[model samples]
Target chain A: MDKKWYWGIIFFTVAVNVIMLQLTTRAYLGREFEMVLPYSIVGVVMAGIAFFTFLQWKKVEYKEDEK
Target chain B: MSECPKSRHANKSKNDMVNLVDNVEQKEDLKFNRRAFLKSAVGASMALGLSTVPFSVRAMMGLTDDEEDRVEIIDLDQLPVGESHKFYYPTEKDQALLVHTVDGDLVAYNSECTHLMCPVFYQKEENKLLCPCHKGSYDVNSGQPIAGPPQRELPLIEIEVVNGKVYAVGRQFRHG
Candidate 1:
């Protein structure tokens, strides 16, 4: 995959996670809900997946360059 | 007497080694300073950000508006058991609901959904408060979202009962 695409995906994932966190906190404040923990965990997992995928993509590029 | 070539080479190598050591020490110092600067910068920014939040929000999870003129105290007997009464407390624009649960616990929350600020309705059949706009369900007792997109627990309004009269005393904002 293209490096730019990988970077774009990373940025987009981070942005989405941040927006979700903000919305979650706002909702919690408004309602005093307890689901913020689960939402945060999901956000963290999504971020990890995105990061892992980006790293894998970079590894593949490195291997290609070596060849 | 001319210095031996070997001695000159040895001196040159020693000078080079000294320069390398100095360069390494400088780089290490730079790294330490950079880290210290970033840490302080981040700490300062975080403190500023936290302090900037509105005082009303920072007070407590259940403290409402401090403005006495905007609060309207209602009687508890006015609302029957297993039913909810919608009223405006603190401000006319902000609507709140006082729900008398089947178990006889009185709970108060903002009738607005935490997700999109849409009004939420009490569902007697489901025994859950429903946010029709987003299908969010909140447990009537805790004002916690049991399902749907809303992540925050409902803002809890503190109430006091005296001689059958209910007064909206404070509001609490709960976060996860």
Candidate 2:
């Protein structure tokens, strides 16, 4: 639990993906085809970060009784 | 007295930090502690990220070529300066306005207000488009929202003058 970095990374991914989704919607509605790809790419990259961070967190949280 | 007979684990003690009122049981803690929170957060992030994929897909589909839709709107001589004419361009359902501004610059825009699809009127005296539904206003030349609840600019209509006739050639959504 000392490594709160896991929480930080997960939360950061959520925040970035939230913004990416909003930008994607606006661009889509405005018919800005050029902007949608970059927003979608950022969203997918943030999702990857979130998945890997969860794996790391699971390892730390479910380790054997090491006391 | 000796330790309570009802106790399941004989070694149970406050110092042991196992299954006490202040301590969570291992199985329950595993199900609803930091692990659960992180799992849910990751799920949300992944769901949100995947949600954007559809928008990208639709954007690519919308990039297809649109047919040329040139339609005669009105005669330039019929619509004098400082006056406005209402017409439909590209489609009959789309209501548009052709404005001959007081400054004599010919401009056109889809009259539907960006806020709520309410039709906006050309205020020739003030040189602005006014939406009665929400008091939204737009610049006659740029179609950008000037005030009120509207946030986006009106869709601009591309008009060309040919032999004293005004024709609507193309339309721009979310124009400046």
Candidate 3:
């Protein structure tokens, strides 16, 4: 429920996404080249979800402080 | 744990408005530290997991072995004096090219691109081995990659002519 906890979750999610992207790129390219298109798309989706969740948590925390 | 009476007594007169704010800020700081510790643990484990995937896949694909030795023999007369032929070497999965150069010399090299393992095809007009995947080129005579992402020369398959029959003796890894 804390801001730090939410930030941790976001960082964890981003780390997982990066690991997945690296795996996918290595599998498809047989080398650590740039992230491929499909992996990039998935990473963007995961990051968007994390950002949206963080924004919603910030809004709730602001409302609680006002009350 | 028992609290020290001396320290407790000393703290009785130290209270201030700023200390209250400091206490709240300290609680947040502790939470952030805990979060950071957890994140590092998760990141390390995830990195370990990610690194293992490639090794596992390589093992499954038979690419994990350091030695991928192979040999093949082709007929000298069949190769002609200025032509080339594609042949599978010691392993069917490994492809190679036998080229009879314009100077009337026999040469053989692996057909897989060093960059990404794409199959390299002989381009007669250009007199080079071309990878369709990335447009990489290798010299037909020397098997040296001349263009594209290939950083190493194509592996040469050593050959010896025995009774006019070409025999691949060993293989050599070439790097620029």
Q: What are the per-residue Cα lDDT tens digits for candidate 2 across B1-176?
A: 45452355544543223444444475577477666777899999999998999999888887785834999999999999999999987688888999999999999998999889999999978999999999999999999998999888887889999999999998887765
- Over 4 Å off in model 2, which ranges? A64-67, B1-33
**Interface RMSD, per-candidate values to 1 decimal:** 9.8, 2.6, 10.0
Say which docking band candidate 2 falls in. medium
- Chain A TM per prediction: 0.65, 0.90, 0.60
Q: Select the stronger candidate by DockQ from 1 and 3.
A: 1
Candidate 1 regions off by >4 Å?
A1-67, B1-72
Alpha-carbon lDDT, every model: 0.65, 0.86, 0.65
Model 3 regions lying over 4 Å from their true place: A1-67, B1-72
Task: Kindly report the fnat of each predicted structure, to 2 decimals.
Answer: 0.06, 0.79, 0.00
In terms of DockQ, the best-performing candidate is 2
- The candidate that wins on TM-score is 2
Residue B24, candidate 3: Cα error in Å is 12
TM for every model, in the order presented, reads: 0.48, 0.83, 0.48
